[model samples]
Target: MFKKPVNDWKTSSPLRSSDRKKLRLKIASSYSIDTAEADVLVPEGILSVKFKSYLNEPGVAYLAPDGDRDPLWFSLGKGSDAQREDALLIPTIYTLWKMPKLLPSLSTPKAVIPIISGGADLMIPGVIHCPPSLNEGQLVSICKYERVDIDGAPTPMLSVPLAVGRMAVGSDQLQDSSQEKGKAVLVLHTWKDHLWELGSKKDVPPSEPIKTEDGAEENEDNTNSKAEEEVEDKSNSEMPANLEPVLPEVKTPTYTPDEVSQLLHMSLVQAITQSLSSLPASAFPIPATIFYTNHILPNRPHFPELVLHPSSPHEPPTADSPSTDSPSPDPSSITIKTSSHKSLTAFLKHAEKSGLISTKAPQKHSTQTDMLVTAVNAAHRDVETHHSFATIGEIEAKAARKAAREEDEKKQRAAANLEIDVQELWKPHLDSVELFEAMGESISKQYTAQEVRSLLNSYFATHQLVNPHDQAYIALDQALTACVIPKPKSKKKSPAEEAPLDQAKVEFMKRDELLKKVLNSMQNWYQVKNGDMGDEVALKKGKLAPIQVVMKMRQGRKASTLITGFEPFNIVAEDLSEDLRKLCAGATSIAPIPGKPANSGMEVLVQGKQSKSVVNYLVGKGVPEKWIEVQDATKGKKK
Candidate 1:
């Protein structure tokens, strides 16, 4: 029995305390031979011997128990002499009963060896006294007692060297010295011979006799010839093996005239003629039809059988189709037959063209394995666009683009239909001031600079007005008048004329008067339409400008309709009389005291001034104080 190497738990480790504990437990649980018994010689004053023997046959050897069981008998050898003692011997005592290998030594001062007689228990000299500290694998000689010599010279004690074990031995009989020694020697010799045979035979083959030196050269030649014969035999044993034989640069299969004739079973001239005629005109030979029904054909049983046709000068073999009794071909089956030596080379061009076979097919492939991977995502967009996973801005842009496209398409369709008046579709609102205001807002909201220009172009084109200035003015009026932006119509001209015509128009009209006129007209139109105020005071040359129109507003007002005007100071004073009463409105009153600085009286105050005379005096840097207060009191006569 073999013992697995034990891990010494006493060694230091990097493991944690718990892990080390578990490891120690596992090591402690690991197995080693625990109970082996052997007779070992201990150096002592009196000779001590121990032997284990069986009544049935003492000459038989035994093996120690696998673990903790008793030793059992095993036949090691036979003995010849009766005078010599023999006993069953355990071989692995050296491994199993070895000391210092986890087995505690027996503590009894005197060892007891058991005895047996007639297959029953008996007592004999017990264990041989041995030193307790012997290491494993150390050999020691033990003594065994035989019957006392006639003269009482203790019959030459049996001496046998033994390896210690973990078990102890007890026997009923003593072993004879000479017989045990001879038997031990025989066993050792037999085991050695067995080991030698095993080592020599490892991977070795059957032996052959060596040739003598005198015949060495001939033998070498013969060996070479024999090797060649062996190779030839090996080649011939397999199909297609002997077909292409090469010996370095020299090859065997090349044809001579005689070989060619022999192969074709015809004269050389005839064979050559047949070979030449069979070839096609093309440098590359016409591909032969290689395809056959997958299954053997039944109509001609043996139809594809290989045969040498008499008509062929070379007697080339053909696979004859099988003949059968059936009339209609079986749908589920097909067979192929082929010649042995010649190859079938089908062009397969039609098959490739028809897609039955791939044109550049791989030698071996699988459609499922070569399948294309499909995207998990499927989304549709216009032909000119791609699907997008849009952010907020991208979504807005896409929507804008789509709207623009739709508008263009609509304009195109409208132009395609010759209309009486495309603008008729959009009736300008004659009422609703609020709607007019909204229209401007919507235009600002929707149209970018480019789009505004495009709208203007289309509007002018639809109205058949070519002067861009006039066209733009009219378009602006129409938009404001309409109260909303009506879709613009598409324009067309000869491609060459369009570019220069577009250029002639002012690209921007930042201060155009026509635009302002249009805005005013639109405002009046909207004011009437909404019924907000049909009587809005239109500023005349002498009339005061409307105050509401002049004031600033929180919301931006379009400057288009707002006209700037200049008024005389008198008119301004008349208009602002109420507001002038408030000092915050930049108005003040003054009076004159007698012989003092001038104060307000009948001093003739002009527009926004305290008094006209006072103003005149200020301009002249002098004023009469008496006149500042008294102005034409009874013509300044009675007083």
Candidate 2:
């Protein structure tokens, strides 16, 4: 369920005061929550309740917001903490968030962080370490991977007990990989989720440093003044994936383009988002150059001499050193390369014009890219934010929403009406090799282009032939060789001669070209079947199985080889009839098969039983020897 608004939860009513007193009395009698932890939740014996819910029966919660918009705690536990999971003393929850000394801790593997945060049931596969005494339904605080700081210090970046969940299984079972596939935790409260949004939207308090084994407080600090000094200043507190714990808001220093690309490697969209997200408070509507140099360049990937001219390190008039000067302005500096934000800025403006993105327009000359771009709304909103990119948050979320939107559009279109395809797409014939696998050898059938494409898709999945890095690419396996586009023999040149462009020409990566390769890989089966230009008509290469010609006995016991199947060979029944008349001494007739539609099939009927002669005539007519199957009526069997 979506979280209730803060106004609905925030109250200092006398009834709530009485409720807190009663809840505190109940916790003291039942659970192990000491006075300090309970006081943090219900401070000064007053409940400045931010969220209250009796959604879960027999156990309700009163959430107190931290200096940051996040919950302190309340009641609700089940089964066992020191007892059965149910039967609670304020839920058996504990946290290492800000108060490491106040809660039980469990260190999960690196991969499990996003999984639990996204609200999926935490599975055992990603859990590397947990408390030995941790039992089912026990609430535990989750921390990220361990970190090593300078001066040989060890510390973990702590947030409020962001995730408090009941253990799905005992720690011992969690370690058993064979039995570790099921849920490991049922998370109750997580930081940045709906619950947190409804509470204290304040700055994260400075973390309490952890002590090292060497008896030193490696990174702890008691910064926040306790008792009524918990309110924190508001800031855009997004943790960009570039750095570990997001660096607090500051006037981000200007960086060269090379630096920015290193952090954000995907696209211009991500570049802009990371830039605006890391800005100092109230710095919005800044000039494009300031935004680009400070945000984009710093996060972008870098190259040597990206910040200054390559030769700028050595002054031209230096007393002791000779200097080289060049007129080329390329790569002079990030500022020059980005054309004073024109290059990167144009990319965004173009994206906006094309409807590929949505953002507030930059101030003209005042904007023409240099215009002020102020962000009024933060990334958390669904409304078009001022991130300078299309969407908010990380690349994964952007991709997910795009996929969902596309799917919805497809469903809507399908519901509206089926429109005729108007792109005028090209459809090509498959070669002999493709036909063998798709339609099979020695078979007479016609397949449409769509059918062939479906066959190609099936072949790819069944054989597991996909590029490991890019799913869109179909990696050609040995099985695909016969149905894949062949490489053109390169012309031998001088030993010293080389051209990178020539090499690039041979690699096909475009989707349409790759699909074309599927079609081009095939040699026209019809061309191979009929001798249109010469005496020799080709057959499927490496075809061990021959075409079949079988003679079946009629009701009167006379045998004849049906000639209807030769249509796939481009041979007409009329032609076969004429051929039969000559081969059978003018006793051949075109006879139709019953039980089928009119003109369903016609066979060459010879007056006397002569399956062998008919088969020999076909073999002599250029059909492969192995391709003919002679059905001997004498034995009433086909060979």
Candidate 3:
């Protein structure tokens, strides 16, 4: 369930002393540990974070103890009802690492680690060892297989727990031997998941061989020996007598250009036949880049490798062995450069000649290098006759990607609709002291431009400065002239260029011009309020600084994007980080801006160079386009 990052996360105050004691007692009772031990494990002053796991199930809380950024425990069904008794507390990988023996453990082969991490349950057939004392619904940890040197001989031992969950069936069912096809444990959390990513993101610690009672070790060795014998027997029964024994060393087969071209052709046919329906009509005339990224690459087939057999020289080589070291490559990431075509454009051109797809010509003024794919000929003979190479996992992955894209679009639309109120106000300068006094108001107060205009008009009416001939023009009096017009600079002038003092006539200005002059003479400021209930934040002196998105290359050549200057917009850093994690499908964190006060806002750091996505998200949140600055330091860096 935690395979994806937790959503809607917000930190609350630290738990109270009374509540902390109750929580400790509950933990001790659930894990069958002493109260003192539980107290030592979970100390006081731990922080609580609230989040929503599922959209329908709205109450989930994460507990992060002191000195740790990653949460150690999480509780489900923890809602507003304080007296609710059904809440379930589960330990995270961080907690399990500190106390490896907290729960009974089951051993699984290393081959299934990735599958289990991808959110699959622990199947019975994959389990190599299980404790006989485990009961249904009891909490259990799943450990990986480790080879240990026991008395100079390699012996397999169960490593520390990498995942934690509940037993799916009792030990009686597991020991029956016939029950070899059901689920052994319902996996809830695993290593490298979002929960682990929330922490320091450290690799799994080195395993220490679990110590057992005197005779227990011998019994475990006997069980493993029997299991190995059974596997050997099954393999020997399946092998033909004429075949040579398999070798330990394995090699990835190299493909010739012609074979790669054939694979590319097959992949194109498969995409046109099976994946074209998933694209909407609105997406027609798709660019070559989009077609390659979203369609062709995902449907590409893996090139099978050949196993060597010296005795069967005339016969075809067998398929590659399904060993842990050489796992099947993901077909979604296959590149066209390996094929003879060398690029997507060339491959699509080849397909066009084969009557599989049609391309739209670029316009005369267009800058694009490649033409768009306008249509796919699904009714063509090759498309209809070709066998599909897409697997169930690939199809499901495509659907998931489509769904995630749609959800992100929905969030962007919602953010764009959010209302932001920005008000521009003017504060009176010291030079306007006499003017404010004449208008019967305090010079220390700030006023909106419209309010200042109204005051000026009222003062003009009282002083009768409006021109009798034309109301659009205002006759400037002594105070208005002193405040709006600047003093003349002293300069030597020739007699012919100088104007006589008595010849200076009365200065007259348009009311609109006078208003502009009045506003320019005062201090400019603005306040921003997001939505109706959001607090209004004001900048008293100058314009608000733009939100900055900077991407810097880290030590391993990975890019990390940092965002700052969100305080003026009244955005919470923690909330924004959570949203970005979901949008980018990567880990995110918030830290206090360096050299800034603790009470000041924080800066959000994400794991990748997602400057474009961050900019769009800010704009959708009502930040104007001109108020954002993006800098990418990785632009010219070589991978």
Candidate 4:
């Protein structure tokens, strides 16, 4: 809209059927088109037409629709009014005043309708409703209050759109009503403007003149005193002569179809380069919150450059402003500029789309959005591929990623197949029957890992081995003291002589220390292979392993008991998180515990000290008690 030169789209390359299809896709993406109207967009009757650009200069525009309905402008390219070839250029006043269906419309209040029609840029406070997706730099059509006939039937002809313009600030900026600040839309064109006159060449029926406009209206019976009074009252209330409306501050879209990716990537490059160049050398692997707070907020450049528009285009010459007496501004439309936070967010979305960065929560099972959206070399490596929207580089990159993933999977499978050495534990009941006293019936059998852990917990709870003041600390009884404290240095050394004579320490073990004591009590057994049953022949030693339940403390000091060995039991994480969120009053993380070996399977992390609660929860959900091991995460040593 300024003094900058432009190229006419009419003079650019001619479009074919395929170009039309691409245009349709861009339209759907740009405007939030619904299913019904999507069917009307096609290429058969498509044609090129000329419309006045935002600067009152002539430029070619595309109309995509069948001959049956009004042909709406779908796309524009190479406009002499803009810097780029693929600009989403529609002035705040021009395109909308002629046909509103060309883009998504936001309705203005009845009182402000005619005023904006006369060409004032919209203020944020005036708008009653705006879609969340509409942000700064987005072009929107302005719709006036609907008109109704005597029978209360909606008047379609009068329902024509009032103006078109770009959003100045996003919806968030308009949250406060008292401020009465910030431009919402920049009107590019309006009804009766030069651009509207040029495009009125089509065979459109004119709106019937209302009887109030010219009294009597060439109809005798319709004329009445009541009608005249109603018209007079309406005119006085709605149309104030001195209250002339002017074009408010607004900018038009410079984004063309092909330029979306290019421009988006350009902004990202600018932001990334700016962000990284100024970053401290030691600030790599930075948390996104800190990165955004420290660098992105203050250093990142203001993106999506703005344009200006005069506040009162229709007003006569004044001391503070110039005259707009002509049909079109001779010099150009008035444009204003401002910085934006919304544009930065848009750039982030673009970066996400191009795989320039990735999001990962900072801590496991954490609700906070302290994510890490770190940039990588792959971003710069793939810039060449973004030139074409549907490029082979993208497809090849996807294929390569898939292949690499398959290679990892193959390696994992090979590793899983290879035999491994393991140690087995068999804690007999006779020697540690005091600890196994809680086992009651099952105390006769050799204890597997789960059984051993369960029996030790039972003994600790039954014998009150834990400090009454603090459950996290255990007061080791004689049964546990022998296992937790080291054995005598020599076989001849008595246990009493070697042990610290000071019972003054109260002989305590922390929760983790008690777990180690329990593990020490179990005896390691051999699962040999390829040998005779007797001692006559040598046997090959094999792996010793059993199902285990483990617990770990996450952020917030919340201890989550993890139930592993669910794979052989066919339990899934999703099914667990789904049902447990209700019972726990919080959403539980049911994804596979990260940083584990491949195919380690998933684990459910219920919130709180949930070892017993989870066991009960699983039992209630019909899980067998034998397969479940409630890893006392509260008692485990730090990993």
Per-candidate clashes, comma-separated = 52, 41, 0, 32
Q: Candidate 1: where is the Cα deviation over 4 Å?
A: 1-477, 481-511, 518-639
* lDDT, residue 369, candidate 3: 62
For 342-442, candidate 4 gives per-residue lDDT tens digits of 34344455566667665555577766555566553334655434222222223445766985797678756654443222324465433454555534635
Residue-by-residue lDDT tens digits, candidate 1, 204-233: 122112112234323334333333343334
Tens digits of per-residue lDDT for model 2, 1-639? 113222244443222555566555555444444332344445443333333343532223344432332344454434322123344543312223434434455544334455566666555544433556678877676654433354775444434444667788887776564562467677765555565565544334444332222222222222111100121121111111111111112121243454433223223344545555566657656565554444444433232222233333333333233222322222213332333323556644544454433446554555264544454222433223422322222343555697579767875665334321111122333444543455343324434446656766776676666666777777655445444545444657653454553354432243455566665554333323333334454333221223445566777676555554554444567887787788787566776755657755555567666667776766555554555666665576656
Which stretches in model 4 have alpha-carbon errors above 4 Å?
1-14, 32-39, 49-58, 64-71, 74-86, 89-104, 131-133, 146-160, 200-639
* lDDT (CA) per prediction: 0.25, 0.46, 0.70, 0.48
Best by TM-score: 3
Error of 3 at 456 (Å): 78
Give the range where candidate 4 is weakest over 10 consecutive residues by summed lDDT.
330-339
lDDT of 2: 0.46
Candidate 1 global lDDT: 0.25
Q: If scored against the real structure, what TM-score would every candidate get? A: 0.11, 0.28, 0.36, 0.26
Comparison by TM-score, 1 against 4, better one: 4
Model 2 residue 69 CA deviation in Å:
8.6
Whichever of 2 and 4 has more TM-score, that candidate is 2
| CA displacement after TM-score superposition, residue 126 of candidate 2 (Å) | 1.9
